[model samples]
Target: MASKLISGGLFAIAFLGCLVNAQLDTNQTAQNIHDPQPQTPATQSQNTQSKSHPDTQNRRSSCVVEQQNKIQCGAPGTSATVCNALNCCFDGTMCYYGKYVTLHCTKDAQMIVIVSKDATIPNLDLESVGLLSKTGNCSPVATTSAFAIYQFPVTECGTVMSEEDGVLTYENRMFSQYEVELGPRGAITRDSFFDLSIQCRYTGSTAEALLLEMNILPSPYPAVGFGILNVELRLANGQCHLKGCAEEDVAYSSYYRDSEYPITKELQDNVYVEVRMLGRTDPNLVLTLGHCWATSKSNPLSRPQWDLLINGCPYREDRYQTKLLNVGSKLMFPSHYRRFAFQMFTFVSTGAADPSKGNQVTQTADTVNPTYEKVYIHCNVAVCQPSTQYNCEPRCFRKRRDIGESKTFTSRQEDRTVSSQEIQFVALSQSV
Candidate 1:
């Protein structure tokens, strides 16, 4: 009985131990399958919810992926609206910061976040206070146009000089001349003479006759002589010597015989020719401060076209009105001078009444000689109105005498949609 009882105790102990091992295994399996345990977010696998999932490798690489809840990381192309939305923040460029977002903790135990379209913010070294205190320009939009050297100063002898040549003396006063010592007997006229000497030593042929032409009639001429109206260099002998003169005898010493001598030889030497003319006092001799616009040849005048007023004049009768294009002047004067020069700057508009509006506007820039009066300009007109809109025709031509020689300059630009009602014009002259 004692042996049987010990054997039974040993078997009972083995059975109990087996039952405890089986219970422990059952509890572990249950815990793995159905235990309601809390999971740390860091250890949770968002893609695959499994106990053995590799959570460490599943984190998003970029903020875009995280925001989009996608695993792929890269810049989105145009096809991707979300990626394009992010791109809209940039100025059609790829910035370094566009790739990812970084988070950092500070020394004060506080977290600081910085955002930028680029990896680096430029000009950040500029002081914030300095930037805040800066001011900016408050003007109309700026533009640039083609720079030009329209005309230069030339001697009465037709010698060209940079603007630096002629000394800008009493840019005022009525009667002034280039104080040069020269002899006389060249062409000297009173009704159209000037008070300046063009060192004309180029005319190998002496002026045979001093002809006088008058554009304006002066009343009650003094017995000595009628004042000068205008003058020009009639002939020249050389290419190098000065050729034109536009001043009066009082402007220089009395003319010597050499000045009036005729050119005999046809040699290569350049000759100088002096032209003396008398000029009248022009009360309207003030420098124009700004330039005027070209004329609109298409527009006609409100008044009737006059009949052939002067005999032998062409039957042509059309006066196109013009308006001002630009509105500023380049000269300043303390007072108006008695003499000046003129040039035409034509304009084209839809409602011009005078076809000559382009040549009508003038400027008082001392172009050539001070004794020279307002240079007469010729304005020719074409069709005032074309059947098609935006059609352009020859509107105006600015004709002036370069010294005593005549020349014309045509405007290259066409007026676009210029309204007749808005055309403004100002003549380029001290006197109208």
Candidate 2:
């Protein structure tokens, strides 16, 4: 009986042990399904690198900021995320200003007023304000969520200029200082308007600064004969005043403002030339342009030449296309300057196959070996004392004998020949 009881107890113990083993196996399987596999050393390194890769790429690429020149855009200790939300620049440690509403003067003698989109003026229409350009165009050049930029010439936009104590100030009074109602429309208060003022103080005289702004380099004339008979030849644009001196002929485009020699021009474009005498102050002395011609080479005597002016007049064939502008007669200039303009042309090849075609060459894609033409212009200038016998004025259609018969013009005294720098003519289809 004792043996049988012992055997039953052993069977029960075995059953319990089997049950515990099954429960352990089930728990292990569940853990394996829910948890990830353990990473190796290399796998862990690769995973870490992948997680950090996007942070480097997501950073702003052009966040260049100088430590000394940084303008604060946020309060101290501002978080990077918050600074970025403000559209301001952040340098990992601090936030700095980006773009804001401002007014400044440009080096080109112009006023630039930028109004940020964030700027607010109560009860005012920004576009319909009284601000305007020289031609009364008040439209902004560009508008974006960031800012609206308005440009105005210094002499325009209803700007008032005043000079005092060697300082020149240009002011745009958008709002009246004395009267609030006279301010720009929709202004609720005197401080609710926009205005701009810029002052230019020169270390030298104001005239020097003005000349520099105008890009007029006045060079002294070299003495030539008994009296100073120096002449200057300048190339100008169409905006140049017809009767003004070189100072008033400021180049509005950079193409004509280049001081480099051998100015380039397009074929058939009008080329304005100004010839002025310097150094002589005699009121009676008058300037006379005897002849003007162009040649392919630097030497005035080179072959393959063209005549523009002959015997104090435009060539007969190009009379309509060439014009001699009267200068120094108006109060704009002293009586020592003259101007002329002619259509730019290139000399056609004399060796063309057909003479009847008149040697007119046109640019085409099939043409081989395109070349630029170098042209040099020469002018014969004379400064003479006018008397009752000879006034030294140009007479276009008068007979040649009549000029030669004048006793005062017998000896060509104070005659100085001047030539312009080389000018290159490019084909109409080619880029300069």
Candidate 3:
């Protein structure tokens, strides 16, 4: 009876242990199926990020990288709005920092910080600052047309240049001759005879004149838009070699680059190039604070074009008028002495009477100054020069008056030496 009882107890104990094991397994299975735990935010973000960037397992490692400055990575094609929100860039794989580019300010004091389009720097926030430019793409402009050496241009409306042997030239000639001189101190000076008016004046003619029509005068010259009134190569010293030059001849020089144009003057001096809009009462002028591009037309693939930093911000040349400033000046480009130069265009609001506003707009259009296409350009062209073999000095091999043989056979005189003081200018005419 004792043996039987012990056997029974052992069997009961084994049965109870089996029941406990089965219950534990059933509870674990139910927990897994019905009582599911919520996923973490980190895990969800990781999974979403993994979809875009396969190598990146989560957001912590790639999307929000901790760099020196809060750099948001992005691609060139990504829109500016989306790039700003996440403080991240769309560098192919959603927000990723690529590289950093320094934006130098031309001002001595307040500077700017701008990022490139390569999804590195955050969209520049200048709203708090008193800056005019908005956050925009900082990509390099594509080359439309580019050439080397210099040549005289053909029958363009104003001025057109074609490549020639040694120099680039204009088809028609003007009273002004442009001379660009490189000073010993790396300062560049360009001299031009600026004709400030549309009408020709009578400046007493000499006997050597063949054309008698040269002397003419109009009392109140017919109103015309501003021609290329003045062009100065803005140098380190805002000094004009020409006496009685405009006050803005040397306004300011800048190395600073903003989203639009980096500030150059300490006090934000307004250098105005005024144009006359027949209907408008206020002054029609372009504000100049020269800002040149560091990237030049050194490569065929990278020539300059109408961009944000240029004088005419929205340079579409549509109904809206825009005028160009910072031409031929250091304010327009990095070096004033590139083999290639700025081919510029600007349209200024005529400040014209808005016909849509039901105002009687009296527009007197002139042939000399039509609607603005490309009013002017600041170019670094090859200076025209005489060949080495050419001889200008009057010589009979320094003849001794033909051995005193009563010589009226004279060597006609010709001026060979050119001076820096005399100003030179050229007008370029063009087509579509």
Candidate 4:
């Protein structure tokens, strides 16, 4: 009985152990279905690296070629795929040789020629073509499998300098050009040879310097009517008596210096005014002086003004003291120049009662305390192209037209208004 009981106890323990083992297996299978195993540290790091550098890892390196290295690599009109198959570079326009040879100018005006270490250009002699460096040698400054760079200064590399028509030209050589052939030793052809002509041209800096020296200001008026006509109104200088006021002589003088404004003049002093075209030298064009007047203020439209010229002629009130000078007839100036002289005077007040002496006023008193007033002279000038039917000369006493008449007496394209610098008139002084 005891032996049978011990055997039953052993069977029960064995059955319980099998049931525990089956429960553990079922839990393990359920967990596997719900959750996946986490990745290892090594695997996660590898995945991140692949995502960051996917393009870099997949793309092949491209060949970098300079413009000077654009020697023909294949026949004309070769496709990009064919060019790649030949191990050449394509710049979307042409197939050119890369990593073979190149010639270009440096920023410092130095010329550089580079050749690859694997390139072979038999019978090519740079020194023979006078392309030696300043050190009188053809040694490479740097050498590697990809590049053998040779540098030569533009001034010392057998360069020629010449000037023609004010243009400076610098060239490597005229007849002996830089040439090289790259191919097998005995199979070089015309297409395999590279020829380059290095040259540089420079217009001299004197033109810009001259312009700076002139310091000419642009005209305030626009180019209209007769096309860019420039008119100048100036007071005649002392040199006026010499040659009817030549531009160079009157340009700088004490009487009408450009640097001096508000020129001082005494009563009854002859004020010579010159009207001329600045750049137009056409002899057929005549300058005509029209309505000229003087105002107390700088504004031409100011009140209390005195008329010196009317209808291209001297005003009837001041005709005795105001007269047009024969500038063009003197042969000292071009036909586009006109001049007139008038005695400097002030206007009489309306109530001063000068009906007998005509409304003009002149200082006859030799008073010690002289009154001075600022005056500005304005003139209407026109350039006329003289022909059979057109006359630029002014004819007095023809007819008096009514004010605001639209009919023009002369045939002219247009009339321009020009004014002179300020003039200070001394009323009671006799000195000019």
Candidate 5:
């Protein structure tokens, strides 16, 4: 009876063990159905691509920000993404448009001649006995120092004109550009006039009917102030840091302001500027940026002013010079930009910043440090070829003087009577 009881207990233990093993197999199968296997890199990428929009597809391959996916622009106006419908850049009140092309600039005693000096116009002696006139296009060239007046955002270009258009526009002409070429928070300044003069000439028909006409006046007269820009380089806790000239950009350019990344070890000593021109080589005409001041009690037009640091020291030649330079300083140019109009590159190498001295920048002499290899500066000048689209038409715009009812006359108007017949005239009536 004892041996039969032991065999039955052993059978019960074996049956219970089989039931537990079967339950374990069922749990294992359920876990296998819910748990996922690790994915291969290719498989993970495929899944990620499936989630992205078609416009952003293959984004991993390119670094350029794809703009077409967002705002679509067509034509020149004040409301789209950019200002100046032609996509031309604005230099204070002036407009610069069209792709860059080469120009040759030259200065002289009579006039600043810029063009293909090699280019010539035909005299065209038609053998007809009469006053002759020849027309040939001339390029733009001159040295000037201007200021960066407006800081427009990529979003508020066209509509923000009244807020950003600090300079005046021409009554007869309007701009056609829209985008600012200064990059995200970039600014532009130019001085298109080094020396200026008003000219008058006679054009019309009939000996005594001719009249005089003057050239068109330049808009927003070549800035009467040197635009000030402060660039600083400093080392904080053994790390190299750089800064732009404008502290105000931070408030407007939050996108770039947050991108103030530290420089790598290799490029810590190098710096760059959008475009630069050494003010002068001889004695180095030193003038600070941000010039343009007004103190009118009735119509006050106050502007930023910078010190005219001549020869690394404050220029005492003009005591009033220290005060805000109300007028843009004359630009001292280099041999490369001596003649013809030529736009600068997108980025150019400039002097590096100092790492010491608390890295502080101010206008006072003690704070002024010009030891860098290149300074962030500009010329009070602009240039363009005839084929280019920029508004570089010589300030020589004029219309023929009007000649009224009396068509027959014997001598030039407002001049000594020239019955000598040495002065010939064509009988043509013009409306200016």
Candidate 6:
């Protein structure tokens, strides 16, 4: 009886043990189906590639900011992205469109003379005859102090007047160029001038009338002032009068009052006038002259004096002779004096090359080699700042009447009159 009881107890214990082991096997199988262990080499590689490939795709996406994206432009709050191919540079204020063409400048004066000097009716001299008369070149080579100032009148203010249908094509006549010519002159100022004479074709046809627009890059200096822009034009009689001299209007002159940027005289036709640009001084003491623009004044010369005659020459020769002309002119013109035309905006080149070479810009074009060009500084004695003396009438701009050296004439209208021709510049006469 005792043996039988022992055998039954042992069988019951064995049965219970078998049931527990089966349950353990079932849980292990379930875990295997739901969750796998560590991944294999191939699986890990595939997972990594899956994670990285989309980032590569996202990086190349045009709409999204990518690593090597082409267009990086967009307004602060807006999504207007401009590509690099387009000349849309932010002025820090706004995205403006600009043309991307390389300018090849050479420091050789002979080359500049060839460039700044307008091509005379090379073959047919019809000006010696009557009826058809055209403008002449305004490049005058003069040595002043350590700098050799080359005043090349880029365009005639008269062309601005005759720009009918807005088709003034002076680009071919004067492409924007500045090169420094090294000679005895130690350091030349960047102020320059452009002369406007009659453009006559010997063909003698009225259809030969040509008009064009001229453009200059921003000034090199941080600031520029339109101090003295002397326009010498010839009337039908060939007598050159400083036609656009600032004619003062007491009411208009007072509209904008600034000690640094004062209008010496009102804008007028047929008389050279002293115009002031909106003046602002930077922390570095650099002054800038904003471009003159349109205003509703009684005078026709209300346009910011365009077709600029001279680049720099302080009206007050005593006060600002040492200062250099900042390259770019300001864009905002006073409403009162917007009709005036400008030729060049004087600038300083912050580069390793010569200061005389205005802005030693590199050429990106394949056809032309990289070169440098000389820049100049312009000064005027007439009305920059009124003379302290009481009785001395403002002297007209008079150039040294040297016969061989080219002189800057004031007018296209006074072609035949000798009295209209007052040599405006006197080189080596005054020590600046």
The TM-score of candidate 2 is 0.40
Clashes of 4: 0
Where's the lowest-lDDT run of ten residues in candidate 3?
13-22
Candidate 3 stretches with Cα past 4 Å from truth are 1-82, 86-88, 97-412, 416-432
lDDT of each: 0.17, 0.42, 0.20, 0.42, 0.16, 0.20
Tens-place lDDT digits, model 2, residues 1-432: 000000000100000000000011112111111111111111100001011112322331223434553444335665677555433467888765433233334334555444432221221234423442335444555443333445566577676677778656665532111111111111011112222222222223221111010000101111122245778777765344556545334431222444433343543456777777877667766777887887667777876667778766787654234677656344333557767777665443433212244322222222221123456678888876676666777666566675445433523587777877677543111000
CA RMSD (A), model 1:
42.2
Native-to-model Cα distance after best TM-score fit, residue 272 in candidate 1, in Å: 2.9
Model 3: per-residue Cα lDDT over 61-102, one tens digit each: 323333332332223343445443322334443333322211
Error of 6 at 296 (Å): 28
- Top TM-score prediction, candidate number: 2
TM-score of each: 0.12, 0.40, 0.14, 0.38, 0.12, 0.16
Quality of model 4 by C-alpha lDDT: 0.42
lDDT of 5 by residue, 241-274 (tens): 3454432222112111212322111101111111
lDDT of 5 at 68: 20
Question: On a 0 to 100 scale, what is the lDDT of residue 266 in model 4?
Answer: 38
Q: CA shift at 158, candidate 1, in angstroms?
A: 47
Query: Lowest summed lDDT over 10 consecutive residues: which window, candidate 2?
Result: 13-22
**Which residue segments of model 1 deviate by more than 4 Å?**
1-260, 274-277, 283-432
Off by over 4 Å in 6: 1-171, 175-189, 193-206, 215-345, 348-432
Question: Residue 297 deviation, candidate 3, in Å?
Answer: 26
Better of 2 and 6 by lDDT: 2
Ranking by TM-score: 2, 4, 6, 3, 5, 1
Error of 4 at 197 (Å): 92
Tell me the number of clashing residue pairs for each predicted model: 73, 0, 44, 0, 32, 119
